[model samples]
Target: MSNKEQLYQERLNRYMTAMDCGKPDKVPVCFGIGEWAIKYTDYTFQEVFYDSEKANRIVEDMLPDFDVDIFSGGPTLWWPPMFDVMGSKLYKFPGIGLEEDNTFQYNEEEYMKAEDYDDFIANPTEWLVKNFLPRISAEFAEPGSYRATIALIKSSAAFAMFGAAAGAAAQRWAVEYGMVGQFTGFTKAPFDTLGDALRAMKGILTDLRRRPDKVLAACEAIVPHNIYGGIAGPGADTRFPCFAPLHRGAYPFLNPEQWDKFYWPTLKAVIEGLWAKGKRMFFFAEGNWTPYLEKIAELPEKSIVFDIDTTDAKKAREILGGKFCLQGGIPTTLLTYGTPEKVKEHVKRTIDELAGDGGFILAPGGVLMGDAKKENILAAIEAAREYGVY
Candidate 1:
């Protein structure tokens, strides 16, 4: 067999083994693209977004230097131009990261005046089709070698929260208004139309306290769009979930009780809805899901994969057991500061501790930053291949 084919087969074997609750030649490792990559590679988000050929070239150049097992789907936030035309707002910091800024002056008052659930429903498809689809279709249609595996689609609940209309309206809008408006609306909306426009986190919390049923209902309505058969579903091979972080703004202010009460129920509903459609969820629970591990553990087996950041891996293994696959826990901070030997030691320890009975994928707790040391990443991958033997 050719060298490339052999390496590919080796990787596939590792992946299949983990999926089947068996041991392979080694533990498979997956790397996520994050802010660190931007800093380390000094590549612009636009370069990664618009030009797949350039992106692939960069990945090929980097692979020899850092032998990661799985390549990332792509930069997580690659919204098209339609988002801007739909009046979607984006929050940009000098260096930290970029996200949809849903704080709109008009939306705050509108939501406050919305006396009942009916006031929140808006059709986003009209906007999406009229405004966004053309640009994305054009971009993807262009011939390029570096096609990504995963495709992220916006959820109706998320769009509604940010002030974009959902359903046929959003899709029709994308088709009609062209790509600019569609991209804008898709990126800038809230989890559900019920949340506050100015303060999306507070809005969700308030809804959880004041109008939970409405939130639940809204979530249900949005799930259809988030699935494979629906307007926004990314196909079977892709693993993408409608991601919503619990806490907004800075950390430390997150209240666990509030999260369980306000977020968990709705999230559960959304996940279950997607589950029924046969899409496995890769939930990126950014904060400590330890407090709610029991609840999370209740999710269907092999259908949900929890990517815990900064959570206790040992406790996670205990709580989750064989119920669901667990990804992540390798700290990014260590990758930057530690030596190659130290990184290998950490990877070995984590694998030895976690990879006993299967249902685990080794990855950084979050994403590898652009500035992360190449040597450290190589060490992590090497450790997995060498020490993670069956």
Candidate 2:
């Protein structure tokens, strides 16, 4: 292999090894981009979020700027224009709903009323298709509206074409750049699914307090859909694996009792089902997960990576070291505001705590935001080589 090919092979080997529970020569980094990189390249949210070709070019131009390993999908994943035009009451996009520069925020009001819980539990698939779909999308504002039906059909066809084109562009870029891909498929926590679909956060919290039974029931009811919803289903490739982002189940949100009953069971079922399919789950436990470390440790061994959120890494590492690989903990604020020196220091501490024997990868606590300085980003990217050698 040429020197460049050697470097690419080395990077992929390092990343895959760590992800699969073996230590590599040095820690590997996954440069996660979520429109923030496009924004970093001085493009507006509307430009990238709306146009695929422009977005793909921005991504292609920017990859050479970082020393990270994996590419977390491409801009084809964003579809706010559809959401905006569709009149999704659930979310307000950056330019259309909020200020142009602001990030998208969830509009967490209950479209599914408490009285409808039983019906939802009985047949969520039918209920969602019949009752919920028409209510949420702007095109289908009125039930039995033919305009909405036509709008959906046209939108679907248009987006399908864009998706195919965008996917090809991303694959072409991946080969050109020699970048590894993360997660072949994905699914959400059943609780998050339920919270996002039937009960918005505010509505779910209210349900938890007032209707604990229904809260648990509805969350439980979503399990089969969550399991079969992605490649985690039967006869899928275990090699590529699934990336799961979990919210609403961690600390500062629910006590152990509430989480055990309302959150973890169904989520566990999804995890275990995916594991049975030989799929490795790279999970972003997207909140304070300290108290749940032991519970996570109790999961089936060497089949997961916890891309931890804002938690005490020292404690989490002590709890999770042997059973699962760990990723993340570099704060986005540091990348956005802290000095390059500070970025290196923070990442060093993270690697020191998490990169013990093996089973550790480096990444930010979450997706990088618009304000993240390129210099600080560089420092974090280079930290693996500087201080992460085994």
lDDT of each: 0.52, 0.76
Overall local distance difference test of candidate 2: 0.76
- List TM-scores for all candidates, in order: 0.67, 0.92
Q: Name the top TM-score candidate.
A: 2
Q: What is the lDDT of residue 3 in candidate 1?
A: 60
lDDT of 1 by residue, 18-116 (tens): 544456666767774343454445556555533444444454445544544554433324333333332233322222234322111221333233243
- List per-candidate RMSD values in Å: 11.1, 2.4
The backbone clash count of each candidate, in order, is 65, 1
What TM-score would you give candidate 1 relative to the actual structure?
0.67
Model 1 deviation from native, Cα RMSD in Å = 11.1
For model 2, the run of ten residues with the poorest summed lDDT: 232-241
